[model samples]
Target chain A: AQRVTQPEKLLSVFKGAPVELKCNYSYSGSPELFWYVQYSRQRLQLLLRHISRESIKGFTADLNKGETSFHLKKPFAQEEDSAMYYCALSGSLGGGSNYKLTFGKGTLLTVNP
Target chain B: GAGVSQTPSNKVTEKGKYVELRCDPISGHTALYWYRQSLGQGPEFLIYFQGTGAADDSGLPNDRFFAVRPEGSVSTLKIQRTERGDSAVYLCASSLGRSYNEQFFGPGTRLTVL
Candidate 1:
């Protein structure tokens, strides 16, 4: 079974401080990892995907195959960065059930100003 | 272009009652998905549709939960004999064709059983 683990349920950090949200996944084969964010009064949206290897809104996640981790990081946290972050894992492309994503219990990041 | 949209933003029903939630995907999107999210938890996949056919429904909890996309654009999820545990936010998302594309999510319908 493929599963995504988000250890932190709630994370509080002051504005302008560096932030890191931990995520660990378990899958037998290659996996596709992604981070989805849900801001207050808004629907869930894609924040970043590991395959892209690009930062969005200053947030970046690096997939470590050896460690089976895809931790999301930011140089400096801002008020707008506060949201519920979810770590999702999907099977490799071309697999029968890869399109559906398995999301972890989300981590709520509260940026204090 | 418009994003995904769900009808009946909020629904309140008594236990054992039936309910139906609607979703209208973005124009030209052939893949649609349904998810259920409880308080403080991430969304859970329920079903996926490709064009007018149900490509996958392994995530559905039971037979009481069923969905249909006859016209390939609008879909409806019907829950029979609803239980208290069924209360959650039903989210609908759509992508190009169920590949590796980002899914566009709707506002979600909040279902409450009392």
Candidate 2:
């Protein structure tokens, strides 16, 4: 079975400090990893996906197949960056192109000014 | 254009009562998904519909949960004999056509069973 583990349930950092939210996965086949964020009073939105390989809001996550990790990172943290972050994995559904995601518990990040 | 939308933003019902939650996907999206988010946990997949058929229903916990997209655009999830454990935020999402594509999510419907 595919599983995603987020070791840290909560992380706090001051402004201008670097932040890293750890995520580890257990899957045999190639996996598509994604980072989703939910801000206060806002809907859950997609932050970044490994396939895009593009940075969003100065956040980036690299898919590490060897280590089975896709940790989300930012060089500097801002107060506004505080939110709940989730790591999701997508794989083949049945025998078709449709895919379903399995998400980790999530990490609540608090960036203080 | 509007994104995915769910009806009855919040619903509170007594245990043993039945409930129905509705979801209206994006205008042209061909794929719709249902997920349940319990307190302090990530959303768990419930069902997936492509066009008018349920492509996958393996995530559904038991036979008490049933969903239908009769017209291929709107979907409804019906729960029988709701239990306290069934309380959660049910989320709906829709993607263009393929599951790999970006999925737009709705605000979600919060269901509470006492």
Candidate 3:
């Protein structure tokens, strides 16, 4: 079994302030980690994935195997970034392509101007 | 092209009643998935379909939950004897292929079991 944990249910930050969303996972084998974001009244969409090793919308998450964490971070936060963020993990099951995502409870971020 | 689409954006059903939620995937997507999101939680996987066959359905909570994708395009999730605990937002997603591809999501159907 796999699990993703996001300790904070809500986070608030002033505009231009730095922000970080913590995410930890428990999986036996290698896992693919992702950060998903859902803006107000919008469908959930992928923000970034660990494998890509790239930044999206000023947000970046590094997968640390030693700590089993993939925390999303941004140097400067904007009001547009206020939304619900989810940390998800996908691992192969039984040697197949069953990439089922196990997600955390999610963190709702509020970036105030 | 349009992303995934789910029908009956909202559904209200009485206890013990059966309800069916619909999902229409992208035109050429071969992999479709269903997930359930509770009030404050992220979406939880329920089932996955590859073509017309279910590649995985392990995330389904119980026997009362079932889903089918005919012709590998549109999918339907059926819930029998709905309970209050079953109230949540049902999300549908699709990927070009199954292996770790980006899954496009729908707006989701808010199911409320009263």
Of 2 and 3, which scores higher on lDDT? 3
CAPRI-style docking class of model 2 based on DockQ? medium
DockQ of each: 0.73, 0.71, 0.78
Off by over 4 Å in 3: A93-98
Runs in model 2 deviating more than 4 A are: A93-98
Candidate 1: where are CA atoms >4 Å away? A93-97
lDDT of 3 by residue, B52-75 (tens): 999889889999999999899999
Instruction: Tell me what TM-score chain A of model 1 achieves.
Output: 0.95
Candidate 2's residue-wise lDDT over A1-113, tens digit each?
88999999999999999999999999866688999999998888999999999999999999999899999999999999999999999876455453678899999999998
Question: Which is the winner by DockQ between candidate 2 and candidate 3?
Answer: 3
For every model shown, the clashing-pair count is: 0, 0, 0
List RMSD in Å for every model shown.
1.1, 1.2, 1.1
Candidate 2 at residue A10, lDDT?
98
Instruction: Sort candidate 1 into its docking category.
Output: medium
Residue-wise C-alpha lDDT for candidate 1, range B1-114, written one tens digit per residue: 888999999999999999999999999999999999999888999999999999989999999999999999999999999999999999999999766788889999999999
Task: In model 2, state the lDDT of residue A38.
Answer: 96
